[model samples]
Target: MLKTVRSVSIADYAKSGVLILPLLSSRKRKAEERRGKTVRKKGQERLLQGNEAIVEGALRAGCRFFAGYPITPATEISELLSVRLPKVDGTFIQMEDEIASLGAVIGASLAGVKSMTATSGPGFSLMQENLGFACIAEVPCVVVNVMRGGPSTGLPTSPSQSDVMQARWGTHGDHPMIVLCPSTIRECYDLTIKAFNLSEKYRNPVILLVDEVIAHMREKIILDGDKPIDIFTRVKPTVPPEWYIPYEDTPTGIPAMADFGEGYRYHVTGLTHDTRGFPTSRPDEVDAFIRRLFRKISQNFTDMQMGEVFQTEDAEVAVIAYGCVARSAKRAVIDARERGIRAGLLKLNTIWPFMRTQVEKILHTSGCVIVPEMNMGQISREVKRVNKGTAKVFTINKVDGTIITPQEILGKIREVC
Candidate 1:
């Protein structure tokens, strides 16, 4: 015998205060069986931990080389890829340390392989110099930072969003990179794919930021079986090998990348370089090179920005959040709506490039914007900067290795409303 409930109410579930296991109907059971087959055959639906999903997503995105050091809250990604990459004829190397891990990934990417490395806060900090090198050299690779507490190995197993600012500016010098934050297991998978795509498309490093909560949480995800994921490979140089200039300017501010041993031999160094890839001390050449790197990302801001809006069409109070904290803000928004508060949520999927246009619009239209982060006001500072006195910006932050609850966000909404 099988049974099904049409829907479950949050109120009822809260009143019960215990986990309820659902009974599936016969039709639902058969559908689930079909999904299981689809998952096995086409690799669509499955219960995946966030870190595991990232590995699958990277492989699907054509990540043929992985070089990473073991770091908690992210080591599982390297562990899984170590076994899986060989089966796909890809290469995986466990480097001696995070610096070596990113260094190896940068080398792999320049050799024309789509590559990645994963780490947590401490390891992420260790990779900064190499990360900057990859950026200045315009090598495409993905970096996954499953954030745990830190300024110095604060908490390993616990979740934190303390690395939000670091992801944007950990590396020294002026450079451009993309950083995406995922709040759910599904986004953990999908954004990993997106991170690689952006890195390839833009010829720069891309950071996928997830906290311990999302990285360790397991969830059922229904991957699309009918449609295949779109993967983007870096644009190869069209010039003849004799005339090929690795850093030649293009309309998109992205140069056509030439792979090593691909009939093109070009120099790559961290120094400011010219079109021919030689270190340039010339003021004009250095200025142009730096601007081009910044322009590639700044000019294509529309393409880089990704976010979600809920109940904001007529909201007077908006909640701006990202990472696992966004999950609580979403629930708080829903509860606020039920209580007749015109509240809404602006969930940032792409944290860097900072959704300025969207944030500006919210600042102008809404009476107040609430920012709740797991860190001590990292993103809230950005929100306030964009607000510029147009609207009130309230911050509710926590960094005690604990997640902010829905009730806490709701309370802030109530206060502001």
Candidate 2:
């Protein structure tokens, strides 16, 4: 029996008296295939730019407010926020400069918003005063410093890892700091969320030290759905608004923020203050307040140490690096391994409050270490300090307002080997 299976358009069958079609058109089949691709199943892949993914991460992290000034290397962050924030029912404001940018972020955080600002080297320098304010007032916010070369107004278009120390000590005296560095586009997405969580958790500024190279590089990043991200909001005050002392510390360093329209009355100052938030002239009170701010970070040191180890389990030589510099070191490690050398990398994603214990263990076990940075031996000192004269530590430094290429690192590794 050779009876043909007929396919007919329902509309044509309904409107006309003829049995019209035997098969669907290629155009119709192609449309169906296109629709199927768009209907995402349990798992699908995506390619994202480093900056675009950061914007997506910020929105997912409950960051409702952003204020920033335009600066090269990090301007994409602000541009992305401008378009994305409005769609998410959030607010984005462009301030006159980086100083005002951080000032607005602190103010917004105080008004019960998850806030952020982004800048490059020069703007980062300008934001220091307000950064100190956020530290003193215990305001939760994120600052992205897409680093460029510089002492003052240096290379704005190029990449550099020169801001590593600045992220920790830039703001000034006795204030707690947390800085995260990302080596890949995927990490750029993931760490932004983590930065927000740390800021809100500890009631301090969390810096994402991105470099110009990573900020501009495009890559394939899988946005995973199976693993849900853990997001943390600041601990709210248990006491009523009338009884709430804004600067009062709970088990956590953070204090619950009462919106200005609310009836709660509290003061905030860059000057040393008390639980009531009023400025204090007493030296002991100032000392105690500063100590509390720093202790909040030091006490929870375990939570902040983040790094990646590749082939380090049984390696004789280890390369230590962060930011884009780690990218070169990674390839160098691969080359060294192929040549019958036991080489590995300790890639740091968290730069500040240097992971001393982690570095110490590697240094004690490993025969030698190589530190590659875009600046002149900033992190090498920290590595040597942790090594404590146990390991032969070598440094490969570059400060020509450019990235250290993989070949350069390989040459150094060969020389040392």
Question: Best TM-score goes to which candidate?
Answer: 1
The C-alpha stretches of model 2 lying farther than 4 A from their native spots are 1-44, 225-227, 249-251
- Candidate 2 lDDT over 233-325, as tens digits, reads 887766778789887765665567666666787887888898789999798878777777877898888888788777787778888888888
Determine the backbone clash count of candidate 1. 0
TM-scores for every predicted model: 0.91, 0.87
Error of 2 at 294 (Å): 1.0
Top lDDT: which candidate number? 1
lDDT of every model, 2 decimals: 0.86, 0.81
Report the lDDT tens digits of candidate 1 across residue range 1-417.
Answer: 001112223564232212223446667656876776332222345778889989988988999999999889898998999999999999999989999999999999999999999999999999999999999999999999999988898987698999988999999998887999888777887889999999999998999999998898887776555456788999998879999878987788999999998989889999889989999999999999999999999999888788877678788999988888888887888788789999888888899978999888888889799999988999999988877799999999898899999999999999988
Candidate 2 lands at a TM-score of 0.87
Candidate 1 vs. true structure, TM-score: 0.91
